[model samples]
Target chain A: MEAWVRKLVTGCLLTLPVAASAVAASEQAVRVAVIGNSPPMSYVDESGKLTGFNVEMAHALCATMKIRCNLLPTSLDKVVDAVSAGEMDFAVVSLLATPERRKKVLFSKPYYRSLSIWLSKPSIKPGSPRTTVAVVNGSVQAQHAENQGWKTKRVTNHREISTSLVAGDADATVVPMLTAVSLMEKPSLQALGLESTVLSDPLISGDVCISIHPGRPELREQIDAALDEIKRDGRFDRINSQFLPFRLL
Target chain B: MFTTSRTPDNYRHKLGAGVLLCRLTAVFSIVFASAAAWLAVDQHALLENMEDLQSRTLPNSMEHQRLARNLEVLRLEGERVLAADNPENRRQALFIVTLMAGHPSLLANEKARNLAIETEIFLTRAAQGSRIDENIRDEWTRISRHLSLTADDISVDGINLAREDVRQMNGLVEQTRQKLHGAVALVLGFLALLLLLIRRMILRPLQQIDHALSDLRQPGSAVTLPNYSLRELASVREAIVQLHGLMQEHESTRDDLQKLAATDVLTSLNNRRHFMFLAESELTRAQRYGRPISIGLADLDHFKHINDIHGHAAGDLALKAFADIIRSTLRHSDIAGRYGGEEFAFVFPETTPQEAVALAERLRAHLDAWVIPLKNGGHIRLTTSIGIADASAQALEDALRLADEALYQAKASGRNRTIQAKTTQLPLPLGGHTDNSGHSA
Candidate 1:
């Protein structure tokens, strides 16, 4: 009975977006969620400003579309829910589109492709269920690790995967090779005999597209068109060259 | 005899059927094998691209994405740590921070790890305070925020890697398609060339053989068979030519064999069967025209003694000598034969008993004077006994019997003598023409 009441309340909260839509014509700022966790694409700088490829691209797109942009910092697990519940318009989450997520949101055109990676000591093999992987909580790595039948040491932050590996809470850590570049360059990793390998798989790695609210199908088209415009203008390439050693688009 | 050469022009290195087949097989194999090998290489390259995607880039991108989300969660937890005043908030924040800071990248790093450590220490000490210190909270925020940024960088890199994999796959597919097209073209070309080779090597030569056959079939048609480019065709033509030569030779040999069949091989005389045929014709003519004809039989005397002394070779020499003497004494119209071993018969057409007796005496005189040289450094003289009979009214067999009886009488009277049979009208079998074709021996 309590569950039914909560469901009713949540359902009503979902309809609140219709009222918001009524005021949307008055140039109401588009609320955009940014996970701000991925770097070079979306992350906070040392200046405590959300500045990365994704952040800059969003600003560029908003400026071109002549729309006022309101940025929202959201976690990866909550970004989908926040946007789905009409609390946000869209999210700049960098994960590739998956069939499961497609059921909830419309995905913008792919901004870039990505690779998954494994970090482990040379003497230790990283596969098999016996091996525990340090994965971020509520992330694809967690799902992938569990799907492999391998135990995962779930962490709250990207840094925790490395910390978990050092603490021997996990036999290895799985992340993108780019994010772990600094960790891999550390002399201590060498002292620890840890090496990183890029894990290439179609199922887990591919184009990273922006996820849009399903209620805003037009927003997905607009974003996709804007993405094409930025690429044509060389803005996407310029940002990619500045941050990465390889092309993303 | 068949004339052969060590390197017959017929069996030269003309385009042989076996060589043509081998070349065809070789060309076909090369085309198909190269095609198969190319396909295998293309498939292998594509498989490599797929393996790379499966094993490395995909897994890495997936992991980084998870880590990126986790870092934001960590930052949210950090804010929670600062905002909450209750012991529950502090306790949860401390547990999360404590677990995260345990990783080597967090603790071992100089800048980020130190802040994470200070935050952990401050949170652990928060039991003494009501809320997290504002200054420590700021530092914790920076630490988590910076870690979040690192997660974003990793995701970008993963995305780039995945893009590279797809690009490589697209290129491989294009290359394979182009190579496949080339292979297809090569196969079609080989088939066309094979058709051409069949015309030059197989089909054309067969038509030549057909023409050669037509030429051979027509009589008086000049047979002009040229050497073929293909060895099998040339060989067939050569066999046909040789067969033609053999046929011509066989025709002439048949005529020679017919003549040899009626003539004696050793004495070169009309053999007994042929001699009787001519004698019978002569008797029929004499009987019909009321003309005279005589039959005579002769034998070499002391012939067994000569064989015992000088072997069958000497006896043969004696018979041949007797035949030569008869051949010399008789006219072309007369017929003579070695009737048996050391024995002979003669038919003198248009001759009476006296005329035959004269001819027989001449033959006797020649035999009496003839000498045969022996291989054993010796010499031998031969003589023969003869008898004549008038056969103007008698059948061939009766006449031959009368002459044989008179020949026996001459042998009894003395060897090497001639005698005449009394003109006998003795009754005998009429129209007696029983064939006596056999070796008189």
Candidate 2:
């Protein structure tokens, strides 16, 4: 009877190795949710397909790091909410990695930089006391304007702020450099003037970065590693060249 | 007997057509002005678009050319670095090489460093020989090859970017030109259409209306006109028709007013002033032709009783009925009218004083027999007293005084009765020759 029990235990141990190997080989395919929406950042196309510069970059990084990335199409506000709630693994939207947002989520190294431009009515000059700045709601830009002792009117979206400047409701608006550049080229923008002064203070410096859920140390390490690899292999330059023409870079 | 005429209505219709033409011409001018404004705006937009395109593309083209020249210079400097000699020259070469490597066109730092090292080694080997050595020459050849490759990469990248920029600028310019051309065409087409519409809808109608109006201004103008195509213009034509009708009514009213001036409004009889004028003319004709003329004055007896018994409306009815009785009693040649409130003067041509007295009696009897119905369910009976006079040079004033006195006598003798005074004896005095005791005969 003792020999029978010893045989059973050996058999159990032998089977455990096969089961463990199967579990290890399967590797529990991790489902990582990446926030995507803004152009040249993360957006879904009319075909319900995920695309854009940040989305493509994220996909490339995920493939290089051997991770399964699921793009979550969401607005910039929702992206911040999802990352904070740990519902998403990370965000690839063009969100400025400000000190305020840094408190809620861990920000990777800045992959892109954009200037803060002053958009003014063509009849008005920047820095004039009469000029009023408009910024999107819940944006760091509004906070930066407030810090600079500049009065700001918060708008619901980028389009509303641009239209407010065009229609002469606001004398000026503050926007990301690329959007300002694109708007300046429009014929309707003849009624607006772009300030040459770039807001490069750290308070206003908009560095677009990937935001990760806090305490996801393992995932953060993997993403950092992949980002470093992408930079080293010149893939970052390739991605930037593809998207730079669409921006002020 | 009465005769009808057509001159008044025809004159009125002509006046109406003239007014309509003026109104139509004003509407045409307003529409033409509006179209001109739209064309002006469209033309301005076209010119602005062209100006915007020129301003956007020209500077970009110039900037691309400057960048292309800078890239060419950098390429030449890279070639010169491979051709230098000596260790010191090579060290100098490295510094220049570093400068070239720092250019944005250089792809990667490693690639730039590798090219810099290879070029420096080639320069070092080349310096060992006074004449060209094969090994050094081969290294020089390799360095040239690398330099060529680098130049190609730089030129390709620069040219591709420049080409893309130029293509975009060209596309914008072409689009602007096309848009300008389209705008100009649209403005011209709009102008043409405006002119056509002005001519078809406005000017032509106005010309037709002008001709019609001018014809209307002339005597005996025709009322017919060509049908206006547009509804608003047609309504104007209809208004002209209605105006013609109104003008006809106005002319008829004027003629009626002329007639009314000679007739008394209350009794539809000749007024006193008009009656006297006609009587004088007839008296002159009678004197010239030696024909007999007679004049009579008739006054109602106790006429104030009619007004006191009933209201003014009943009084008016009584007066109208009395006048009607006298009118029916007179011959067509005899003229009768309300001389003053209750008094009437009549002039009869070719009649004696006795004949005038007989006519007066007939009028008095007719008025006495006539009874007028009142709105108050009562009837009014009236009577007139008469005085007859011959239409002679010195007796006309005496006749009117006698009739007035006779009316007073009829009232005093008895109410509701008529009396007559002869043409002689200066008929009873104004108050029956008033006595101190108010006696009556």
Candidate 3:
């Protein structure tokens, strides 16, 4: 009887964590794409750790849904493809929805608008006809400039656009208004005053939305419901004000 | 009529088709600007969330989940240690347990960490061939439960933090949406108001001007422009007023030219053709109204003899003097003109033959007393013969012929005197009248 009791005790101890693993395996873990370069949305910080609005939001959403989040850093251009290919579950980045992207992936309701504006040297006139405008490669601003018949200088990102303008490699550049604002805060950039507060008026776009894999309409619905809850609870506002200098819906 | 000079003020103040469009664009721009500004701010906020997720929330959650996984591994390995039937398997399980025990990410809670340390020690002793008892087994079970509980607590904290971050982001998105909606509403309202103003102040006035111009195309139309309060619209009204005034002036100028064409250049009076026309018109009116009208003629006595003696220049002076005297003597109701050469004629409406004689006498007397001045410093006296005829039962042509005959009679009777022509059916007046041939002076 003592041997029987020992055997039962050993059986129970051995099964504890294995049993937990079995239960977890029955549930799929959420996969999230995080961009390590895009700031304010999702990026790697000075501490060399992945964090940002998108990353935090993804984690929080997973927590709200009672799922495990497996986050992976990805390139901006590849995020959609990764999500589409099911290599990643969802992507949180400074992504804009376009027809081509919509074909491959589903987008959540827009959460913010793209407030792009032009920055140029003070010596350069505002809206100089036919002047080359610099834009981030693979960005909506670049496409917009091209569509408007303005010559565009494509770079890697907003910072590179600013650098291109400063280096006189481009006549002017379009960046998110926030990026411009922050650039203006820098003394070096301020020295090169961008004459016009003229925004990308005609090109300003609608709200920014989340991108989900095409087959995951249910996931999108779940995320949307979570968003609705946060909105009603005023939690969204708090986080928005904490991260953004202005309010967006 | 309001007339303003074409200055920069007019151009500066002019409103046109673009104004309304500009207003709508401005409203839209403002709304879009507000939204853009908000988005920019939100982007910055999003950046901050990124930082929080990467640097804080995500890292903390990862650490917590990792520790939880480690604890699970340690729990499973502990089971392996308990179930080990061989020394080598027991040693392998003990090694893994020790690795988990020493992991830096292990739960910081003293109780959980202590439980892991205790499990590692028990397993190490088991690997060292220590005797196992019911008490040890029970102790192991209790420790395992505590370790799992502690890890669970830490993992839950991480998950909650992650959830809070997502809630925050979602909240921001909703807030942005609300802001954008409000901005759109404001823009729409402004655009509506601007459109209404444009319709009333700009389009309405333009339409009125269009209507006025159409009316002006009709004969004898009067231009009446509507009042406008807007500077540009008012300027348009002013332009229409000036145009209308210009049109009226042009009409007046045309009438003046017509008058000039009918006037005698030298005498500054109605020429012979106009006088004849007037005579005919007056005769028609008298016949229509049943009012008596008379025609008369006056001639300078021996006007050709004077021209032959004193030069044609003197004759011209005399002629001018006679015209002046006639003009001075005739009432405004009477019409007189240079009939031809030295002959002068008049038509008096509502006048009897007797009254015609009286008027002819007065004109003849004035002419007889007038002196002509010459450029050569010599003066000459001039006189006239007068003839009278009444319209009574006569056509205009007949009256003119009778007047001409009467003038001839006056010359025949005597120069410098008046005579009345006899009507075909009526006898001539005998009082103060003569039938003698008038001698040339």
Better of 1 and 2 by DockQ: 1
Residues A150-178 of candidate 1: C-alpha lDDT, one tens digit per residue: 87788866656666777778778777545
TM-score of chain B of each: 0.45, 0.41, 0.57
How would you encode candidate 2's per-residue C-alpha lDDT over A46-145 as one tens digit per residue? 8988765777788877888897666666654566777888878787666788877888988887765655666565455555685678887656677777
Candidate 1, residues B1-441: lDDT per residue as tens digits?
444422556476577788878988997998799898988898999999998786667755654554454445456666666676654444445444544444333333354455556656665565446555677667666666676776677568668888999999999999999999999999999899889978876788678777867776555454467667777777787777766566566766886897697788889998888887778888898899999899999887777888887899888877777777787888988889868777788988899877888878877777677777777778898777787888998898988888888787677665566777866543122121221221121
Tens-place lDDT per residue, model 2, B349-408, is 888766766676667667766778888788877665565666654445665566556556
For candidate 2, what is the DockQ-based docking class? Answer: incorrect
Minimal lDDT window, size 10, model 1 chain B: B430-439
True contacts kept of 1: 0.00
TM-score of each: 0.33, 0.32, 0.42
lDDT of each: 0.71, 0.61, 0.72
Mark the regions of model 3 whose C-alpha exceeds 4 Å error after superposition.
A1-249, B1-156, B167-260, B375-378, B392-394, B424-441
Candidate 1: give the TM-score of chain A. 0.81
